[model samples]
Structures are given as C-alpha cells and as structure tokens.
Target: MEMLYAKWLFNGKEILKGLGCVSHNNMVVDLLPIKLAKKTYPEAVVKDYGEGVLFSGFVNAHTHLDLSNVSIEPYLGFVKWLKTMIETKVQANETQTDEAIKKALDSLIKSGVCAVADISNTLKSCNYLKKIPKAIVFFENYSLRKKQAQEKIAYIENNIENIRQTYKMKIDVTAHSVYSTHRDLLGYTMLKNNPKFGSDLFSFHFLESEFENPFVNSRGDLFEMLQEKGLIDNQLHFSSAIEYIKSLGDIKKGLFVHCVHIKPDEIEYLKSIDASIVIAPRSNYYISKSLPNLELLKNSGINVAIGTDSLASNWDLNIINELKFLYKHYSHIDPAYFFGIATTGGYTALNLHIGFKKGFYAYPFFMETTTNNALEEILQ
Candidate 1:
C-alpha cells in the first residue's frame, strides 16, 4: 500500500520522467504516470522523491567476494599481486576468510547491488549470500598440474551435488583461466555444467592481461610455472585462448570476464557466439596499467556487464564506485551506457530478470539530482 513517485525512474533500460512505482505486500505491483497511479490506488500512502532518479539496484556480474579482506595497492603488477594474494590465502585462517566474505556481502548490499556473480575457490561466500536476491557462485578450477586436476575432478564427480545441497547455493565448477587450469579440467567442467542449468553461462577469466596471450602459447613466465614432470609441451598450449576453448566444444553464451586484451577478431567471435563479457576497469588499471576499450565495448553487440573484481586487485567492491570511476576516466563513453551495463546488461549476463519488472522483487535505490543530466551528475 505504498505509492512512490520520482522525478525520473529507471526500469533497467530507459529513464522515464514523472512515474510512480506502486508496491504492496513488499512487492512492486506496477509503474505508471503519477495521475494514473493515483486513480489506480486512491487510498495508498504517497511519497514523492523529488529531484532525483529512482532505480532498481545494480547487478554485479563478476567479483571475488572471498578476497574482500586482502589488501591491495596500486602499481603492484599482475605477477606480484598474484604472489601476494596466494601468500595471503595460504596464511588466512578459516574464520578470517568467513569474516571477509561477510564483510564483502554487506558492502555489496549497502552499495545497492541487487544480485551478484561471485567467483569463489571454496564456495565459502555461498554461506553468506542469503540477503542477495540473485547469486551465482562459480567454484574455480585452478589446478596447474594434472594430478591436482584429477583430484579436483574426482571430488566434483563424487561431492558436488552434496556440497551444493549442504551450502544451499548454486555452485558450478568452471575454469580460472588459460594459465591456471589444465585443458582437460576446463573441457570437463564446462561441458559438464554448461547444459544442466538453463542459464548455465559459466564465466571464465579471459584475457585480463596481455601476458595471457603468450602464456597460452607456451612462451611466457606463466607457461614456465605451469610445467610439470609428466606434462607434454603442447598438452595445454593453444594458438589462442579462444581457439583452445572452442576446441573443447560449442558452448554458446559463455561469460568472459575482464576482457582487457580481447582483440578485434575475438570481439567478432564473441558476437557470433552470443557471448557476454564483464569488465573490471579499476582492477585492470591497478594490476596492468590498462583499461579495456570502453568505447568499443559500448558499440559491440555482445552483452557487456561491469564488475569491481576483488579488494585484492582493486580498491573496493562497490559497483557504484566502479561506475563512477569509469564515468570520470572513460569520458568518451556516455554515462547512461555505464549505468545500463551495471544494471540490465549485468542481469542479462547472470541470466536474471531485469529489475523493476512487475510481479518481481526490486531493491530500489536513488540519486538525488535536479539536473537533466541526472545520470552524469550521479556518476560524476
């Protein structure tokens, strides 16, 4: 029995002026003109959010909630950051990781994130995501050795369902990247999970660094570390990450994360597969001193979403702060475009319904502004 009117309302798409959102029993009922809404709900209590835009909160398409407690600083290059993060993981106790997961979820909630696509190694964050309306916990397959990959595969085959039931979380196994996961593990997990769930768009950390190109082809530092006693030189090597992955099978609609170094032909391939990508701009700048081509991605037909990565790689897990960063630095792109990816594109990527739909839950948030450039004002 509430009627909330705003100067502008965003429905995960276009912004409409002078609309009222009607909700009852804590669920959104309809959106209509203020006058029409009045006629529809004659006895409802009303509140006008004057000089502002009211929107359903954002969907964070990709993040590592488990690393929320890991401290990060700028200018720590990718390799060093990875080493530091590994050291911290080795040292951090179970309680510490649990606390970090709780804090990360709380931060995302307070920052107005409606849903999340969280990358987890242990599915520990799954325990704390009760408050989020939609959540996808991607358990990473990051074994560099065949033995480790075999052990993990055995565990997944025997205990994945039991673990999911125990956690009460939708945990799906997926590859970490070209350098970390073995080719066998990648194909097995992806082929195993990609068709079971209707929206089985398992995410991959693809091409976040320029070094990955050489690493995948067995010519980089990462490749040297990946060498094991029984592993053949070309057992895991490929012409490109995309080619190796495509060799696995035709997994249409895969989610590619941090595509900072995605090439032109690769972009065309992504479009052809109807793929989605999540961009972590701040994390890229912090680790590699480069941001993805936001202008180009904005024009690309592939579904695009945004992420904050983790505190281990970036400052924080606030999608708003991330959007603001993109708005300020990547000024060539329109602010609304950033906003769109943060909302609709992210939901699309995660296979969740767009917010503000009737008969659905909408965690509404707002930006107070009188300017016609409300999106720009809020973002800047």
Candidate 2:
C-alpha cells in the first residue's frame, strides 16, 4: 500500500534503486524510474539502508511440519529413529503440536521464507497453513506394498483434488520415497496423470540411507519388514532405487530429497533426468548421521536447494539457520550462492514466484561480514 526503497532486489539480474519498490505488504511493486523518484507523490515514504542485500524470500522445498509437535532426540540409526517416531505419536497432543507448528512457521517467516514444499501426512495442520498467505502444502503418499498401491494412489489423487478446491492455497501430491512407493503405483500416477496429472513435479526421498539402497535394489530390509507386517510376500520383484524411477520413462521434472547415500554414478543418472535436489543437511544428520555429497551434486552442475525437514527429524524449521549450518559445515560454499539455492533454486523447482511484494523477500545482513546491523537498522 505504501512505497519503500531497497538497495537491491533480485530479478534475472539484481537491480539497485530500480523502477520497483517493496510494498508495505512486502510484495515487490513497480515504481516510477529513479529519475522520477523526487517527483512521485507518496502516501508514506521509507528509505533504503543502502548496504543490506535484499532478495526474494527463501523457499523450503521439503518439510513435514505436521510432525512439528514431536520432540527430537538423538537416535541410533535411521530405522531405529523411525520406530521411535511411530511410538511417540500418541504422546504428541494438540497443545504441543500447536505451539511447535506455530513457532516453527513463525521462525521460518521471520527468517524470510515465503513458500515451502512441505509434505503432509494428514490435514491436521492444513487449516493452520491455509490461514497463512505464504505457505503451501503437498500431501505425500507412502505405500510400499504392491497390492495397496492403486487404492492409495486413488486416495491421494482424490485428496489433492479436494484440497485444491477447498483452499485458496496451492496443494499437490508428493510421492513419498523411492523405497517406500511401489512400482505399479508410481507408474499409474505418472501414466494416468499425463501432462496434467502425471509427472506433476513429484517429490520423494532417494538414496538417503544404506538400508534403503539395498531394500530398493534387492528388496532387502524394508521388503522383509513389509513381509513381517503381512503387507507383502516373496513374489514381489524389486529394482534399484533410481532404476525403478527411471522405469517410469516420461516422469522427469521432480524434486529428489536427501541424497545422502547417493553415489557418484547415481548423481550422473540424476543429472541425466534434469530434476533438481533439495538437501536437508540438519535432518540428514539427525536421522541418518550423515550429510549429502554436495560437492558431487555441485560438480555435476545440478541445481541444489535447501529444506528444514519436519521438527521430528529437525530441531528447527528456520531456513536461515539451515543456510548458516550449510555455510559452516561446507566451507567451500559461497553464502550468496547458498542463499540463491534457498530462494531462487527452491522457487524454480517448485514453480513459485517471489518478490518484495509478497513479503517474501530476504535481507541478509550477514552478507556484509563487517557490520552486525540491528534488525530495525538493516530492515529500514
């Protein structure tokens, strides 16, 4: 509603005192040219700090904030932690959940995250997200048993249609994980959906753990687990993690989460498909005691994004903190480049727009590396 100036804002290229001003509502608004700056009548005026780095809001491409109500503790292994998570579900009640999700969302927003490609297991937090103008939800589906695939896919497809019609916010279906989703189900979703439904930018976990690698390649542990649970039998044939996805043929355009155990050859294969990657370093460390081979992904010319996974596996859903952790652990990573990954990379992967107009802009005061500008001073 009101006009304000920023030293810079990201476009195809960065603009400084350009013909656009950030609106009071935080969406980027077009302004009169710098030459007309003095003549433009203003209802209210604000000045740029002239030194801070201003850019579009960050996009967290992967998260499970519904589990935000759960407490995080050190775990022994991936499967072990998952078991604990299942056991603790009954203990996490509404009050704790409300506090955690609300706080996590607040922290993410304050750190300048405008959009998230969050995975939802249910509609519990759906209403809360609907209330926010920025956040979006992707209801994820996870079914490993081959027989259950069709029914589960139908449920997801119907649920997605329902959510889109019901809410003003955007909603989509994220295929759970390479190991968790059955081959037939993946094929049906990609085939039946076609241009509109199939290959609809599906998100899933891939090669995040050693156990997953074998389970997918040879129907190992998870297969055995399913068998023990009476979900599957010995007859179900399985393929390699990436191979099963490749078998889908036409499905490209996707987000692959947590490639921690991803090999060099697998990275090459992923590169062939042209899908992007979202590395949840903190979450990876918390669950698997490992981090992704960012060096490999970067070297392969793969576009990388960042995500603060759910509170169950992550301590906080703060993108700034995630970026900071990335900077600290991976010393070779440039802060500006990593910031771009968090914003532009994520936005492009999920097909979302960002600008000052959306209050989806980030001001990285730390980029200067000299002045610790107070929040008010830098924002002004």
Candidate 3:
C-alpha cells in the first residue's frame, strides 16, 4: 500500500478529497476530507510532496494517435487541408510513427491523462497503447465507395474481433464520418454491434464543416469533390446526414464527434436519442475557423465532451490545452462543469467501466484540493 498527499483529489463525480491513497491496479482506494488514513510503514515510505493539485488524470475523448506526424498545415478551408492530407501522407513516412505516438502518449501522461479515446486508422498504434496504463482503441472504418461498403464493414468486423482476441483490449468501431462512409457500411456496422466484444460504444465523424452540411444532406459539394478527386461515382441522395445515421439502426448511446455544423433540428433529434457529443474545439477552429454553439448545446441538456483531436490539426494533444481554449472561446460555459465533460462525460461515452470495483475495475486517480471548487484549485 502507498499513501500520497495532494491538495485535491477528483473522484468520479467531482467529489474532492484533500488527501488520498492509491493502491495497485492504479485505483484510488481511500480518500479523506482531511488526511484520514494512518501510514503503516512510515520508514519505508516516500516523502509526501506538498501543495499541488491532483485530479483524476485528464481524459482526452478524441484523438488520432496514428496521425502524430502532423505539423502546421493550411488552416481555414476544409478542401485545402483535405487535399493536403491526401497528398502529404506518403511523404511523412512511418519511421516517426512510433516517435510521434510515444511523444503524444508521454504528453498525455505528463498532463495527468489516465485514459484516452484514441481513434486508430490502423494497428500501428495498437502496440504502443498495449503498454499504456489506460486506453480504449477506436478502430476507424471508412468506405465511400458504393460497391466496397459491404466488404469494408466485413473487414472492420473481422479486424475488431481480431484485435479483441489478440490484445484483450477494449475496442470499438467509429464509422469515419457522414461524408466518408456509405449508408450501407454504416448500417452494417451498427447492425453488427455485439456485446460479446465488450464494445457497445459507437462514434462517428459528424458535421465539422459547413461544406459537409449540404454535401451530406443532399450530396452536393461532397459529391463534386469526390468526383473531382476520383473518390466517388454515383450521385447519392440523402435527406440529412443525421437521418442517414439514424437509418443505420438505433445508436442512441454513441458519441458524435464535431457537431459544429449540426443544424438545430439535428441537435434536437440527437438529444431525443440520448446521444452525447464530443467537441473537438481546437480541431474545429483549425479546420473551420469557428466554434460550436456551446450555449445551445448547454441549454438543450445534451451531454457535451471534449477532445484535443490529433496534433496534425491542433497545436497540442493535452486536454488541459483544450480546456484553456474553451475558457477563452466559450466564456459563458463554466470551467468546472466543462472539466467533467473531459473526464466523466468522455469516459462514459466510450462505455468505460469507471470508478472502484473490488475485483473488476479500479479508479484511476482523484482530484485533491483544500477548497471545494475542483476546477479553480487545479487550474490555479
């Protein structure tokens, strides 16, 4: 047993404990209003470093660990960056894949991130996450080709099962996005969602850009871009992107990424379904130069979470950076309440079994503070 003292400890529900002791499996076993536990082995113990805030390690709800090679690319317009992303990948090379992943992981840990919802495009980063303390992998699937959607879904299903069998790690499917995924692929993937894989969480790229709005709703600019880039063939028809996703069967409990361009009706529809939204503010600003309507989201009572996205688009991968940015942009939203979105809201969105379980699960970390305000003390 080991005992440590922090100014504050954050339990699952934002409960602050002045001092706490964390046991093996990296869970907070005991916490107190005022340093309550007695040390059994004083001589063998390490010194208590005093006067610092400790909260449950931060949780980054969305990130692309594989895209760690990202540097400054063109910001503002969607098509410019999308074109660059397509053309630049072959040149970036894979030697830095490990280094970038390592750097991002290290940065997450240093920032007190205990868990992450990392979206994986391939198995390259899976090995790195295998050794991390806590991580949930989101295997990304994309199939815009009509003839290839079925095959793509089949591939994703098999790959997910393979990953589960190999690492015994928690894995979930994230249909790449409304614009990149075909209707059939989305439907098939949702229909194949099984409890056997220990993955019930669903995530998908939503409206991050105004370009995607008309394109997904009526297959407008997206279709033209696809044809121009040789990425699409037929003229697809859909009433709305949200409607297309809903048609993919019931995904009432999934995570919807980047609702910046989400229409009011779509937001209402999503709320009616009990779905949560993961806002990638930095990435949103990087791509679209605008922030989502936080006031509307708040008033709608929709659960909103935070994500740093990948370094390719954002300056950093730290969730704290995300929080600080949010503080700057959406001044109306409470920092303390938003912190929960980064931690508990994100964790729950991925269906992670959080908190303390005697034999099953372990609480990762806690926020400790002399004051009752968890966010104020930690930020200070």
Best by TM-score: 1
User: How do the residues 132-239 of candidate 1 rate in per-residue lDDT, one tens digit apiece?
Assistant: 877888888667677788888787777877888888866767778877787667776666344443346678998887768777777775555445333333554678
Question: Could you tally the backbone clashes for each prediction?
Answer: 0, 11, 11
User: In model 1, where do residues sit more than 4 Å from their true spots?
Assistant: 25-27, 192-199, 225-235
Candidate 3 ranges with C-alpha deviation above 4 Å? 12-24, 39-49, 72-74, 157-159, 192-199, 355-374, 377-380
The true-versus-predicted C-alpha distance at residue 81 of model 3, in Å, is 1.5
What's each prediction's TM-score? Answer: 0.92, 0.82, 0.86
Error of 2 at 134 (Å): 3.6
Write model 3 residue lDDT over 1-380, tens digit each, in one string: 55555655445455454555544445545544333455543432332545544455567888988888866563747766776776676445677777888988888776767678889877667778765556888777776788788787667666666777886777776677877777776665454454433236667778887767567654555556666887764554667676667666766467788898787788888887777899998898887587877877777777888888888789888788788777777655665677777767766776655543323244344444555565754554
What tens digits encode model 2's per-residue C-alpha lDDT throughout 1-380?
A: 44554444444223344544535555444445543653554554655545445555667788887888776585556876765765575454778777777787787767767677778877566767753445667767767676577788777656666677776576666667755677766665544345446546677787777777567554566556555656443243345677667667766677888888777777777777777888999888888678887777777777787898888888788787787777667766544566667777887677665644344443322222124332222222
Q: Candidate 3 at residue 239, lDDT?
A: 70
Candidate 2 — worst ten consecutive residues by lDDT sum?
Answer: 367-376
Report how far off residue 312 is in candidate 1 (Å). Answer: 0.3
Give the CA lDDT, 0 to 100, for residue 116 in model 1: 92
